[model samples]
Target: MCLLLNLFHLDLETLEQSNVDGPYEPMEADATNREHETEQGGTRFSDFIPLDFEEEEAVEEAIRRSLEEETVQVPQESRSIKTLTTEEITGIVKAHSEMVVTEGFRSIIVSRRNVWTSAIRQFRRPRFVESTDMLYVTFASDKNSTEDAEDLGGPRREFFRLLVKAIFQESGAFEESPNGFIPRLSVSHVQNRVYRTIGQMMSTIIVQGGECPALLSSVVLDYLLTGRMFDIRVSPEDVADLELRDSLKTIDQATTDDDLQRAIESCESWRYQIEGLPNPVTMDNKDAFVKNAIIFHVLLQRKSCYDQLAEGLECYELLPLLKENLPLRVLLEMPKVRSDLTADVVATLLKPSYSVLGSNKRPKEELMVVKFRDFLNSVQEREVEECLHGRTLTEAEKTFLRTLNPGHILAFVTGSSRVPAVGFQPSPKLSFVHNENKYLPVAHTCSNELEIFVNSKNLADNDEFEYNFLVALMNGANFSAV
Candidate 1:
């Protein structure tokens, strides 16, 4: 959970490094639209592909023709006529792997600087997108790497991290809160379709087998999912305006009419905000006034924003899934800090492939692998001391220490900081990196494979292996080519 927070904080630093910060300025909207138009005119994967309508019609026509004339010949020599049951038919089709339907891959290339804009433009392009299309991401910066299902995982994970920051922090679509972000009441944002686009991105991430946003207020998610707000409550601290919240807090704590009147007079907005309130408030109705204020500020004010966000979420058939799948729904709104990527869970889930194992006795290579496993378990046990009184470390040393953890290793190998609710597909692999000269660990994130240096000389050099592994993971953390 702390790692997840660090990941978000790291994303913010990336945004700052890219020289892009804050909400969209009024003047920048036109420039963004123009850039989007340019993207449409530039080279696009969508242009080569035909629209869904034409393909569907052609497929249907072909199927109709084939069914009308096709006939199957069955041998009738001394055979009893027995009807096949539904289960039997299903079993027959299940036997053939090719006959089963599988998710399609949707490949997208995006610039790191304009990830949100480029991704949305590609999503909106006229093309057939399967509801369950696995999103394959490629950052424009990575020019040498080939696009394959295995190689896309790292980029895809990083894409979600960046998109989370872009939509919530950079887009200025929602108000920041300690619990989660609440939708801000903004007519201009709604009119610009900001909320809807962000909603579509959120749903796209989920359907494409990526990380959930998990940054929305629980109340907001409940309303969006069920279309009803039940047992909804908001903290007084959730109120963004410091002065107004303090005034309400004072009013709520007031005992007598004099104290209530004084508290109410402190805030000028109370003159018109609450209706039918006695000028000199009494203890009897103070609670009711506070409740109304809370409702007005939290729910009623952002009603339109919520509606727009809901519309966006329904973009890629997410509504039904949210309604039907309890776990997914919970995960989508689960707080970022609630992630359960503990060391034990990650170590248990990793699938290792031994390079040397044939005799009854354990191979030295196997022992080194076990040593590496023990190191992963101890990652969280070791305190990450970034400060040493007044001494400062070199840049390389800092990078090495910062990334020496189980979470970073999991992310380095799997492309996600948190474990998926459904768990990892093709479980993360532990393989040995055999070289005469000891080398750092290499992670092929696309295939979820981690290669540790386990050569003959380095089998017992535990400290050397640890140093090389941490340095390698840190060096390649942002290198998405693998």
Candidate 2:
């Protein structure tokens, strides 16, 4: 196939201009008459006329000589034609092909005005034509239209070229043909491909580390300009990592002592990239990302500057948003004054606190207080007992619970008052018990509240409500003017 394609490139003009001469040919009419008489049902190009014995012998010998020469030369040409391996071809196609609205049947006229003057003037005229339309179709133009159309064509072509380059960068290929390997050739596809490629490349660079600051800055700028980082498919893991790196750059660029101090204080231990980090610590978690970013900021400055970071302690309340499992095992590993303090620690330190009250001491009332506290703490827990009691929670109540923690269950008994403390213990038995109470009215209410809050917030579908609430809270705190 490739050989035939190459051979097809023979210059017709050059062939016609060749000096080769042969026996005189018959007139077209005579040739046609003979062809009609000997209609052998073959193509006109292939039809041949009878020749004299001597002529036929000469022709056969010439043909044989030509065939022998062709067999020898063809292989040499084939070898020199610059063949690409399958992988190379795949990579090129994957990198470059993008769909564009190159040709369409639409006509539009665009105009621009000088900002200083209120005068409007004609700018450019653009017209789209169907694919089958003749190439170089003339624009039937008035004087103004002609000038405008010509002027527009230059910029339009340039714009398309830039767009194609951008698309190439995004898709990681240099070709624009639809038959190229990259899928989805529309503007949307290009945008998405560019966004994804940028993100992936940035991530790879970060992981590799020691990248040039200028390159890093360019990547960051590209992300900022495109606003593609906020798209749906962007992995939270990538966002968190990039955010930390960008924040570090921001900290490094801090000119004021106050700014440096703020940056140092915001950094936490989680952000440090120690060599040979432990298994659980190295795993990808959104909380881990936030924690690492915070740590990275802190470690970048002098230890004495840490004293200025007392304001950052408030973020400790958002620990629940960092990880879903409550009572988190990490919390349990920490020193505690009392067993009940586990609940308090989770409430005060983490975003959400879980309390299983006994059947006394105003169980429902206490539950509401605890539930409200969870909301304040940013921990959302559904009350299992409430669901078992066959009551439904209102939207307000559900939203209130969502403010506490997401994906947390508060298993309460109708008459229970002394809430049981299960300190960050993970057990199948407990999970079963929790699942059993999931359908209770209290559980239903809390779940409904979370749903309402989540809907109202307009957070991304994959976003955990608790995480968003924490982010909002942190941003508010950080940006707040005292």
Candidate 3:
């Protein structure tokens, strides 16, 4: 019986330790075998017993709790990560070598060509033949260098050749590298060469259908003499005169390489002379000659020349000359003449009584009134004020308004008002005044009625005063009928 019981107990322990799903059946079998052995030669087998329901339940609950605990926590080994060094990172980048290319070279060459073209064109006429010829030679040098480079095949060689040729054709110039010497060419020389070649190729067309060379000659002479091209309004007769055309043809015939080179030097000398000429239109001395020239250019509708003249006039010390010669738009656009100054000037001009005093107060007012009247008349004739009023306020005006606060509104009203008002006065001493008290609410009904009566009855002779009084009342002034 003791043997059977020990055997049964061992089977139950094995069943609990094993992962088999039918541990109970295996336990029963083991128990039965042990019982048979006991019946054969031992005492009772009832001593060997299975687990009770309470013990089974406790075992299952313990297993469930163990699983929950395992799920809630993560193993420390699984959370660890590895890091890479700078050398390792560089190696990864190097392994991906397909990312870079030779496109940057082409972009650089294209940009160089664009800058070269713009600089050359700025002169209008080719004025540096030697430099231009050098540019052509440089292009040839580049082409030869590229051809030689093609012989040594590489990834970027063919593209380089194409680029060199494209730049050469576009610039009408070439580069050459001979015996380890790099030579560059100028764009002016190339343009002159191209023009001469074109002229020679189709002389008959120029002689027959083309406009006379006299026109070009006049343009050149005008540029030389006055630093200006002939106006676009030049009549055909001006160019077709036999003497002028013949003279022009003589100059045109002299368009050989050497002559063109001399002409370039002459043109440069002329440019230097113009630049060196004492700008009489400067701030120190407002030259009448320059002012007249500006007016003439303005009349001629030469915007570029006019703008240059205006720029020169900006340096003149005479405020009157500056004011008179400069276009309103140009004056307004000046960096030094800010919105405050402009508004002040415009506001002063708009007011009938405001005078720009210059030591002599009595004459100054008269002078101002006369000038203002004249200005008003001219502006009215041109409808300038209407046009300006209709236009939107510029950034400068917005900024001025921000700084001036409520003062700008007063100025705008005073300046833009028709049936011109008297000068703006902060107090009732003037015909039109700013009433601060009017901006406050009335305390009594009779005060409000008095305000209304004052507004309705224009007892003041000055229309501006009545208008301003009404404006003041509307803005919440206290008044009484008495």
Best by lDDT: 1
- Cα lDDT of model 1 by residue, 360-391, tens digit: 32475578767777667656665333222234
In the range 314-388, model 2's lDDT, one tens digit per residue, is: 121212211222211111111111111113322322222223455332343333334434443334234422322
lDDT at 200, model 2: 30
Clashes counted in candidate 2 amount to 40
TM-score of 2: 0.16
Task: Kindly give the stretch of ten consecutive residues in candidate 3 with the minimal lDDT sum.
Answer: 44-53
Model 1 misses residue 46 by how many Å? 33
Off by over 4 Å in 1: 1-102, 124-132, 142-152, 229-231, 255-259, 270-281, 325-328, 336-340, 355-362, 382-393, 399-405, 479-482
Worst 10 residues of 1 by lDDT: 45-54
- TM-score per prediction, in order, is 0.69, 0.16, 0.14
Q: What is the C-alpha lDDT of each candidate?
A: 0.55, 0.24, 0.24
Candidate 3 lDDT, 1-482, residue by residue in tens: 32443254344334333522221111344335434533443221011000001113332242233222111111122224232222232222222211321112211111223433432332223233111111111111324332221211121211222222232233322221111101112222222332222222112111111111111112212222233432322221233223333332333345455553443343232222323223322323222322332222222222222222233222212122313222111111111111111222332323333324563443534443343234333332433223245446556533432333222222222211110011111110011212333422121111101111222122222333223322343342111100
| Candidate order by decreasing TM-score | 1, 2, 3
Query: Model 2: runs farther than 4 Å from truth?
Result: 1-105, 110-155, 161-246, 249-264, 267-287, 290-482
